[model samples]
Target: MFAYYLNKTLMHIFYKNAALTDYLKSINIQQTSIGFVPTMGALHQGHLSLMERSMLENEITVVSIFVNPTQFNNLEDLAKYPRTLDEDVKKIESLNPKIIIFAPNVEDIYDGKPSSESFDFDGLENQMEGKFRPGHFNGVGTVVQRLFEIVKPTNAYFGEKDFQQLQIIKKMVAKKNMGINVIGCQIFREPNKLAMSSRNELMSPNEKQEASLIYETLLNAKEKFETNSAHAVTDYVQKTFKKNTDFKLEYFQIADEVTLLPCLRKNKNKKYRAFIAVFINKIRLIDTISLN
Candidate 1:
């Protein structure tokens, strides 16, 4: 019961915007360094890795667990996106009881209007995941910028699992001159090498196990990329998926990391990474690997 009472009394969670602001005022955070980690809240080991780093690096860590509605392109997706607040809180508290959680409702975040705000993330708004999802980054920019405005964190954390999204957030911070350091943490994966994602919760045990092929394929493609043409590497990946027959391959491209454009040939001086999106039934999974 000491632990229970400790959690009940010491846990710092804010569900309302005004309450959080008032609490921040009381604490006078001008001197404290805050690290922010935002998530849609299907707490996995992957999410914890980011939180763990934040807890170690800063005086205060704010982990926001809201499923931003604007980022989803479909109502079906928005409705189905996992929200595991109670479990998420448990996982976070396991690391450190003092960590702050900003888990606001739509009204708390957007004043109940629930519309997206747009930002220019250079040409990054037009590439890779942007080409497929359409306005997904605008919605991402909208919510992240609003969170930055609200939390005023000195530094923020993101995982490299969503590599394109990572690039976009960096661009948004630069364009706005937000002065906050956005740290991109390494991708966390399962024992099978599948990148951990909230969507993995939607898959069955067999499907989740089978999804490991996606990363394995990317690894093979990376090896092939050393001697093969970029076109040849993608074609090899395309055919590999065709052999599987269960996974619906969306798009696979090897691109320059900074420009976010497909690299037809190696420049030798520049770095590149392979990005892929695949579907296991209705669930979509994305992963990236450094090719160079």
Candidate 2:
């Protein structure tokens, strides 16, 4: 039997809109404070950490494991993206929180057409992940907006690993005047300091070891930020990764945390962070670190 948890007790699974709505209705969802954590399946320690935090703070926690195809800029990525629904459910069941797993199919959520709604994130979507992946944030904004409407959670949790996406979602909430609280969780990492990511599943043992260099480089850049200009530090990171053959450095920038615009020089009044995206063994890996 497939066992899940609700209210610190065991329960069965709920899928699609009708079943989920009926289940929530039976539980009087209106009176409960819901915490939502949306994922694209391929659950890992990082995902579990988000759920753990949600359970600690809210009466009911909901996690969605839909691999939203709209968010992928590349067709191959969407196709190759890991889908471990069975394993993911087992992980969620282990949490034993009053959690709802909204594992909806594309047609059910999208109504046969993915949202083409464009959002103006005040240029936040124009850099980094934006600059590289065209139409990615619009897809993100659309799906997240729909999810918010459907789940209507009091507070939603997101990891800071996708620092840019976290910021964009927050901006979308504000701009849309959505009353939901968006919580930014810490970036979970591996023992070697490589940030935990679903994409890490695609890496071979050697690629995984070499991927640690991404975090190591970020740490080096962090130290450089202490005594160097923003441009100099960025240049240093670029050159260092250029020397390594294991990964292709896509783009690295030291930018204002709020605006996400590349900083020409560090400013005392603003918080700066180093954002990086690298292609290791053809898998795109991203990581960020605070410069201030």
Candidate 3:
């Protein structure tokens, strides 16, 4: 039957990892460059963009979807998070990627034991998302470090939407001498400009529509800088969202991209970004925009 052949074809094309070491050995012997994009399933346009870039630049692309439990500070949020693996696989197959999907049993990857290995980033983790959701970055860094060890990727792709996390991961790679290049991909958004996120799946119809405001507000904030509008910076963004009762504004401030320090001045040549985090229907959303 066509179904049988389809199943066989899908296995060969998408889910190709038989063993971690075996896959690595094959790539090494062939001298193929490996690119990785790690995600927590519920694949969205944002994740695909990373994979597309990896496919274009490297001979092999590997994506892992683990819904890392270690990364979530709230058990309820973790349970509510989406997981559409069957559909996610179809999406990956459409890319026709020279890709391997690493969906391992937790025991295989983490030995089914509680992970005591935690990393402290010297105050980097304490800022932004860290201030609100403590222990998040350590969970992020822990799984990412494990992935780096398993994949040993020549290059890895992450999104700028998680700007703080990206900075910390880059620091980990550098300080630990991991010998992996971490590239930050631009945030992919919908036509209405909501930054694409797996958590967006949990949003109600109205919540998703209202979530567009997060990005729109950042755009307006960026324009403030572009037009050299020196009036109260954070005050402007906070006041704009104050009208939206459905959303709880987390933080809306412009900061230097590299130093993660708030930008108190408007200089045309100075690189700056507008970062915003708001809760729509109790689901937290984060986004950033460059002020050019």
Candidate 4:
């Protein structure tokens, strides 16, 4: 009973928009570092981890849950993405956060003028998941820039599961002289090693069970990379993926964690990351693992 009451009280504390901005200004934020975690609604433990980290490390934290339609390359997928703001609000309020939760509707956020600023690179946004879903990264850049403008956080947290997205955002930040510190958090996975994602909510009971294959394949690739040569690792990954005829493989590549450029050989000199994307009945699922 007491817990329920506390939850309600905390929920009421979250101020929206101008009120939130006023509250932040009312408080002297000088030297009180701000941390931001931007996401589309459908809060899960993965998102909570980012929030918890931000709380631990910063004096103030803001979490934005705007399901930016522009980021969705597919209109159907955008329409289908889940929204549980009431539950999500309850979830974040429990943290007693000095956090501003931004939950804006589509029209409220964008003017429908297809963001004029689009990002381009030689290979960063052209391969792997980018190759599979064209123009997806443009949507990412657009919404991220919007969030940066709204929150103006001192540091932002991003998960490594979206390795390419993370890299692209960092590049965008640097290219534009945004000056905001972007921290890439290690991907949070389940006990079975499946990377946590909002889309996981879309999985059926049977699909969830079979979905473990994505993580298993990544784990297999990691093992092969450590002991076997690059050629052997590539061959094993291809063959293992072929066994899972039920799923359509997107792209699986090992790349540097920092630069995100493809890594061919296993070496201790630098950290490596393994990225994978697959489709289970047209629902795209992505996961990553550590190679080093």
* Candidate lDDT values, in order: 0.88, 0.87, 0.79, 0.77
Query: Weakest 10 consecutive residues, lDDT, candidate 3?
Result: 1-10
RMSD of each: 2.3, 2.3, 3.1, 3.5
Mind giving the per-residue lDDT tens digits that candidate 4 earns over 120-181? Answer: 75467876767777788888888899778767788999887887888889888988899999
The segments of candidate 1 whose C-alpha lies over 4 angstroms from its true place after superposition are 1-9
Candidate 2 segments exceeding 4 Å error: 1-12, 29-31
lDDT (Cα) of model 2: 0.87
Instruction: Residues 25-46, candidate 2: write the lDDT tens digits.
Output: 6775456888899999899999
Comparing candidate 2 with candidate 4, which one achieves the higher TM-score?
2
Model 4 lDDT, residue 26, Cα: 71
Cα error, residue 127 of model 2, in Å, equals 0.9
Name the top TM-score candidate.
1
Predicted structure 4, TM vs. truth: 0.88
Summarize candidate 3's per-residue lDDT along 112-173 as a digit string, tens digits. Answer: 77463678676678777887887889889988998888888989999999988999999989
What TM-score goes with each of the models? Answer: 0.96, 0.95, 0.91, 0.88
Winner on lDDT between 1 and 4 is: 1
Please tell me which model should have the higher lDDT, number 2 or number 3.
Answer: 2
